[model samples]
Target chain A: MPTVYITAPRDVAPEIARTLVEERLAACVNRLACDSVYRWDGEVLTDEEAVLLAKTTDERYAALRDRVVDLHPSEVPCIERFDESDILDAFGNWRAESVGEG
Target chain B: MPTVYITAPRDVAPEIARTLVEERLAACVNRLACDSVYRWDGEVLTDEEAVLLAKTTDERYAALRDRVVDLHPSEVPCIERFDESDILDAFGNWRAESVGEG
Candidate 1:
């Protein structure tokens, strides 16, 4: 299975999380509130935001990104996806079960 | 080679990140300002915090944790580590090179 962790402005996490799950693009979404400091344009500023770690199949990644962007509050939300191997069997099974064998 | 990632509160990220890299416990650190929403104490409250993703070797994980706690601002900073496999050869080599072999 592949894991995609998206970092977005805090307020929009719940909306994005609910949408991904309801749409079956992800099996589960773990949301966390945190701060982010980075260089945007020229200046470095710190702000509070929400983090969403979403578990999904590699096949569904593209669709998930499109959906997330549509629902995200920021213009360029951080959407990073990476390949994960040897995932816990129980977690992988749960993810498959959540999305009905997807 | 084994790879590990740590996520910490936003503000404490820089302190922890700098400490880990300087001490040769980590190869590289990615800092993001994000929001984390979770059950703390008895209620779910929202807060602004820095997010840190530190890349380190498996051997150094224990010491890294101890050092991060010593400098972290929060009483209980979130410290979670898991095995990461199929890492890019370049990245793994960079990590090893950073800490000078293991």
Candidate 2:
């Protein structure tokens, strides 16, 4: 299983996160408010954003990613994958069950 | 190189992030406000927290982890390691140099 890390516009992230959970692509989504600093057009810019950590199984990752691209307003969305190196067994079970996995 | 994922009290997160950056334990720390839901002592609880994503190198991770543990007030702090699966070359270079890895 992997947790997908994604950054999206602050105004748009909540709905997208809810959609993923409602559609069963993720067991749950953790949304966080952030200020993302990056270099764009040769200038450093800081923009308000949200980071979504979606707990999902590997089987659903591709679909989750595609849906994010479909919903995200950014032209080049920031999506990163992280393997769960360590996790509490009970929480893992809960997450797996929530996602309709074993 | 890896990004350390840690959770802290919302009020304490900012200072911890700043200290890590100032002490060179991390090149930068991304802070985000979140509400974490988990089962504690047979009760499900949701607590407002801050997520600290600390960018550091392999050689520096142990030190970073120790520093985070020291600063975190939680009896058992949440600190997870994530290897960079893929990153933009220029960004990677900057991150590496920022942490004194390059």
Candidate 3:
């Protein structure tokens, strides 16, 4: 299974999450409040952010990625996909059903 | 490289994250506040939780998993490993250095 990780500003996290679920791009989206420190424009910056872990499968990844980019607020959002060797069977089934025909 | 995802109670999140980094099991830990819905003992429950994303490498996964299990509060903690096909080179180098010699 593939889990997509996306970091967005705190204020827009919920909306982005809802869109993914409503559009059937993900079975579930887990949101976490985080303090992000990274380099940009040759300077290190720290900011409060929200990380969304979207549960999907290999088949749905492309569509999910496209939808996320469309709904994202940042011009170059941090969108990354992760592959897990072990995923709970029940959760995996649910994800497949949620993103049907993706 | 591997990113380990662990879910802990909000109260213990910071400690677990700090321990992983301080002990060099992970280069960085990103914490997120989350609402988890899962099944336990034949009942479905929802609770406030924290998700920790630990950045490390393949060589350190075993030790990191063992140490996380030792330090975790839950009897069966949610410790899952994720692999990314695309990791930024700079971040990957930093992770490799942080978890030196596994």
Model number with the top TM-score: 3
Rank the models by TM-score, top first.
Answer: 3, 2, 1
lDDT of 3 by residue, B23-64 (tens): 777776778788999999999999999888887789888998
User: What are the runs in model 3 whose C-alpha is more than 4 Å off?
Assistant: A1-32, A36-47, A50-102
DockQ rank order: 3, 2, 1
Which lDDT tens digits does candidate 2 get at residues B9-30?
8999878887777666776677
DockQ of 3: 0.19
Docking model 2 quality class:
incorrect
lDDT of 3 by residue, A1-102 (tens): 888888788999999999888888898999878965443343334578888989888888888888877888766666667788798888778779988663
Q: Over 4 Å off in model 1, which ranges?
A: A100-102, B1-51, B54-102
Between candidates 2 and 3, the one scoring higher on lDDT is 3
Q: What CAPRI class is candidate 3? A: incorrect
- Top-down lDDT ranking: 3, 2, 1
